[model samples]
Target chain A: MPVIGGLHRTLKGKAALFILLLSVIGLGTLAAMFLRTQREMLAEFEAERMQIVEHFVVGTLKPVMLTGHADLMSGIMASLHSAPGVQSLAIVRTNGIEAFTDDATMKKVNDRLGENRFSRILKEPVQIVPAGDPMLKRAVESGKSDFVRRDVAGDGTVTSLMYPIANEEPCHACHGDDHKVRGVLVATFGLSASEAGTLQSMFWFSGIAFVLLLLTAALTYLFIVRIMAGRVSNIVDQVNRIVEEDRFDKRIVIDADDEVGQLAISFNHFISSVEIYRIEEGREKERLEQTVFERTRELREKNDFIESDLKLARRIQQNLMPEKFPTPPEADFHAAYLPCLHIGGDYYDVFEMPNRHVGVFMADASGHGSSAALLVSIVKAIVSTAGKDISSPSYVVQIINNTLAKLTPDDSFVTLFYGVINLANGKMSYSLAGHPPPMVYNRDSGELQYLQTNGSLVGVFDFDRFEDSEYIFQHGDRLLVFTDGLVEAMGEDGKMFGRERLAELFKDARYERPDAMTRHLLDSLASYTGGAALADDVTLLVVDYKKG
Target chain B: MKITMRVAGDVTILDMIGNMKSPADLEDFSGAVNAELDQNHLKLLLNFKDVGFVNSSGLGRLVLAAKKIGDKSGHLKVVNLAPDLDELFTFTRLKEKIGVFKAEDEALRSFQ
Candidate 1:
């Protein structure tokens, strides 16, 4: 469907409508042809009636009046009156009975001769007569002759003609009056229009027949089109559904040898092809899956060397942690880290400072594995130098950023939760830079609370300020620090093991020991993954404070 | 496959004269006989006289038609079936579904 000036009209729909309109035009043309033929027939009927009446008027009345004999009309009347074919005939005088010059009319001058039907019509304006009606006043006037109109008779329609009698030389002499005009002869022409009635009947019958034909054609068209459209549309719908849903479980049932049956037969062939395609598709899917499995097994076999390399690297990274925790005594040195992968970029070190405060520094470099480990190594070197007197973790992070800001690529950053706990007074200072804050597991309240002290990612801008926050650690409170890799591990359904799920997973956890707790949490995550491939590294650290 | 049938009053002789690969031919023959039987209320003597094979679709069609005949308060008797066809018919258990006879006369007599 296309919108043209906001009106949606398609060429195919317009073409179909045009075809239907052409059919209607053809039907209308048929009707017009029928009406035209009927009009010709009516005209022919009227002309034939007029011609017959003109024959009588010219052959009988005109000659009689030319002979100047009144007896001539009466003789012709006598012969034509008794004829059964002639319905009625009357000769009316222009003045009175004395004006009837015909001899046959003279014998019954006072008698009502052939005047019964003529005068019986109460409305004298339009009437039916065989030898014309008495209303043919033209027959009395200046010899005007004509057939009357085709009008309603007792049974059907009829026509009449007037045999006009003029006041000629002989008729004028008989009058012998000083006035020029004399009474004229009148001949009634009554033509029962049975032929025209029959013609009219044929016209109406044909019209009705055509109407019936049109109705039948329309009805049959509608019926056949309905059934055919239903069947075809049903097949089309089924085919569409089959294509959409990719199913070939049903077949069309058509028994006839019509086009629709042929279509169904072809459709069955199409369905057979579809069935073959679906089976082939199933086989293809299975083949592809087998190939993928084989390839995966091969890849995993080759990956053993890489895993060993990563394990070696992890041992090297772990060996770098503080050994005995007695560099500067009377301060707690505790940390925990859970890496998502066999290796990760989350590393922390707590060393005793000369000021009796433990220097705790945690860093999460960008990404995982060897690249992140390289950057973490750089950060570790910078921090190990700064850890001597720089107990404020935020300033330490700022100095690391000033050193590494030129090394990072575009959109590359990391987050860290760094804190130095003052074992003397239990005052801890920390800075967070876009990292999930350390979860303080309160043994007193049996709740986990996150401490918020914010800083930006290191290695971003050289002059950026890093805010430092300090708080006193409670004896029973446990702090937990983790990298995003732990919370961002994906499940089979594309959902990440987000912070909320991690919290829920840890809601009833009581490993009691830092190493066991960290190991348990990491093992629980690996189990939740169900041997699925990991896309990110996992790293966490847990810290439990005991009164010194 | 095409089917042939001849109706003689209360007895309708049906010939499954062609390959009934889909059982549709059998069903068509049976349905024709049953329609006549229902319309005329005649006892049906259906002669499976010529059917040589039947497929699942064909067998299904026949089963459904026979069930329809039974629902219409009528009995159908099948006869003149070849041994192979009879084996196929027995596979569908048409004898258990309706009534099967070995001879045409017996099938006709079952109409009583």
Candidate 2:
């Protein structure tokens, strides 16, 4: 299996082996036929020799036999037997005996001659063969000549012929016309040494020639296979080098215009395409990198510009709030503002109105960032100018609302809680415009209340109105007003720091000064939010009524 | 927020879902209102059964939508407010400008 497997390892090797097998079969058959034909010709030549000798014996002995010269016939047969390559010669009588061995047939033949010319029968006339020999019997019965080949101990090989002598009119007188065959001439001749040697030479020559032919075919096939293998190996080596070096530009050499050469050309074409694609891919990658670099630089520059502008806006917005609140003897004020972004919409202010009245203002414009910041600025301007003289909180709020409603978009609005606390009487009048109610905690009664009032969002409806809600302020009554951001700050569980929590904080911090109370509220809010960033602007304004 | 529109008689019912907090929610609610107003379907009912919280920004959008409908001489009303949102509406006096109904049928009947 391994030998056969080796033979068919490659296309060339398999093809060569196939051709070698065909040649061996063809030459082997040819040599076999040649030897067979030579053997048959040698056999026919030996048979022809026997028939000629048989004809000579019959022609010479028949006339001599008719003259009844038995001695003379014996001499002739003996001389023919002694000729070259003749092993034995004999004439057999029809009675299954040698012709001269039987006295009756001899006597009958002598009487027919009418002279006793064959009186003395030749003793042992060249023993023809056994009487029961099938060749001799068949020749006698069929009246025809037959031959057989036999290997003899002394002479290597010989052909034995049994020729039947016909009972013609002349032979009838001696045999009495009873048998159709008068006798059989039995002859055996050794094969000619020269002729055998020639045939053996021919056999050797055919065998050697066939071997040479097969050898030539095999060598030719091997030579072709070696040549093809070398070329293929060369191509393989070149391809390996190209792959190892990562050189797509190199092409395999096409030496011949055969299948192997075609493979080389195809590989070259593949390499060419790879080279082109690699080049294009490299160029595309470079182009993409360049584009990304440029875009990144441009975006970085724009981001820097926006960051700077936001910082400046934040500072301006911070400046808009009151630096210090009015310290009227009736109340101690504290406030904290934290923007969710660089700028915020939440605003708060504390200023002396008139005659010991403190004006307190807090507003949260809808939305946040730049747009909401702009809205709160407008609110500050209107409230500052309008509330300076007019003490009616609702009337001042109405003026601001009408101005903003005409000036801002329909979706733009502010929620504000503005109040005037007259320190002399400890009375406060405030308008709550869409704002969360402020918590008022009283120290004396230990009661917490919300100054809840209803007012639509400013700047949404042109005809929208706001009215004042009155609250009586007492000493130790602390008021906490805040934007929705403080209460709506979401905890990790998505729950809000709601109004109830703020109310609790405000009540808990009742004994603390307004500043300490505001700090506690913010700290609680920070705790509620788990220190996460606020999602909206937060503003806390704590005002404690200190009048006694 | 996801808003699906249906009709009960002449009133177009906008079933509001999710918190109307983000600016995108503002756009969605206002867009639904504008779409109804564009079709001249004056009677609008906003179903708030599935609504969660409405932030200040969200409140502003609601007012804007109401104002738009009012400017077009069409009525935009809301129903099925959660308790908190109902109090919110009361506190903000949004109920003064936009109708608040306890039920879809009652709101739809108001369009008559």
Candidate 3:
């Protein structure tokens, strides 16, 4: 179903509708008041016409009746009846007798005579009949002069005036003085043409006024729509354009100091503010981007410098380890070094000492990476210089521990295992400083022995003592010396590659050559740890004695 | 790892929970111990009953922590170690450097 909404949907439509409605209500009220006033004025004019008619009839009839001139009275009444708008004029007797009148009254009197010889013989005898008009009878009985009424009779209005003829002193000559009223002079006047003209004129005037009011309303509606709605709509369109295009630079142009102009001014202020914010935001974004770019460039340069420095440090640490071991005729030596990071703390070296003894050293600093590598470097310098002068392994370890304790920080320490094998006697004397014990595997007996010696962590205390334990290397005996990294390596199940597992591997790989056995140990470790990255540096040194 | 420290008499008891396995865990543990040392709380007792595991790096951190405490002339002790952890301490011979107790009260008394 379609709805008939009022004209308030659009600003222009609503304005025009309000204007038209107000004009119609105002004009309608004014027209109603005008019609009411015109009706009152017409009624007053009709009443005045009745008064004049009554005065004229009473003035003309009173003189004639007092003169006792019935003929002149009858002639005057007959002339009045024939005058314009006059219907009838007659003198009606109070005792049901009508005296005097025009042709219509004479005909009524003749009809009342009805062949009566005495009524015909009387010369100008007054004929009596019952009073028919109630107002005339009332006027005669009351002796009141002015009595009038109006009756509508088929397209005409008949105004009747009753003027009572009182019994004056002159009338006592012919009549008795006891009578209060003698007769009623009744005048019936028709107002068909004049009243019709007045009504017609009133209708024409009202129609013209209504048309003029409609014209005024229409003109007012157009003027209001043009002056107010059009400007307001233009402002609205400008605002919509600004919003739709996101062009905060645009503004509404208002020329008047009206409410709409104030609205446009506020809108322009808001748009200007938005435009300023947008520019500021753009500048902020650019500044942020520039700052990020500069920071990123600086970070890249620093990273490049640090990377090259670390590479150099790694090279130096690698050089600290022995590249070639001194192969004594009694022993064959092979080792594997796996550092978990770029540089590590585990180090091993094989060198010849005095008395044709082969010295083997393996050490692990506290942690991995550059700091640990640096600690190991200090240990390497001390050991390489001190090993030449000190023949006894225990004495050399004691000197290195004391030197490290003085030089290193309190939290930094190294666990070292140093051993020297005398080629002439097949006796290997070793010292352990908080390091994992070395394991010796006998190929002939199929037995494994761990060189377990109690020692405090080196570099932690200057007074810490390391005991030298001697092991006789039998023929076909294989010795494994390694850092704790090897045994402490963890598998996925959180279990370490413990000493038992390493001893088992040592026993199993006793028959292989030294190099092949080291490879076997590493492969076993890889399999145990599921080939994951080693958590620490693993350094293993295997020395196999074929003949001692 | 979560570490909480409380003072009992002259002893600062550090209650440790969770595994100290990753480098971050080791750093957190060492940092906490160092912070306690910085405050001159030398007599430290580490309660490890709730600690599930300690990797090789974590052990190295513990060694470094013990050394740091010792260097400051502070006494550090560990208590309530799990079975594997106890074996690790014995195997690594860290028990020689730091006292290991089976109970918190014993470790605290040892501090005195």
Best by DockQ: 2
Residue B83, candidate 1: Cα error in Å is: 98
Q: Write the per-residue lDDT of candidate 3 for residues A364-477, one digit (tens) a residue.
A: 887656677777888888778887643578887888788878987765678888888888888888887777778888899888888875566677677787778888889988
1 or 2, greater by lDDT:
2
Ranking 1 against 2 by DockQ, winner: 2
Instruction: Kindly indicate the candidate among 1 and 3 with the higher lDDT.
Output: 3
* CA error at residue A266 for candidate 2, angstroms: 3.4
Q: On residues A400-442, what C-alpha lDDT tens digit does candidate 1 reach at each position?
A: 7777777764224456777877777778888776565667766
lDDT of 2 by residue, A1-548 (tens): 33333433654566667767877778778778877777777667766776676677678777877654567777888788787767777788754577777677667767886877667664654445766777777887788888777754422357777778777666665666665887887777766656567657867687778778777977787887777766777777787789889998888888989999998998898889989999999999999999999999999998888787677657657877998877766678999987885455889999887687888999988876667778888888887788875368988888889988988887889899999888898888899998888888889999888887757788788877788889989877888899988878898889888888788778877778777877888888888788898888889998888785
The C-alpha stretches of model 2 lying farther than 4 A from their native spots are A1-240, B2-17, B23-44, B102-106
How should the candidates be ordered by TM-score, best one leading? 2, 3, 1
Candidate RMSDs in order: 35.9, 10.5, 12.4
Go through the candidates in order and give each one's C-alpha lDDT. 0.61, 0.81, 0.76
DockQ-best of 2 and 3: 2
Stretches of candidate 3 off by over 4 Å are A1-247, A252-263, A389-391, A490-496, A528-531, B7-10, B18-27, B37-40, B50-73
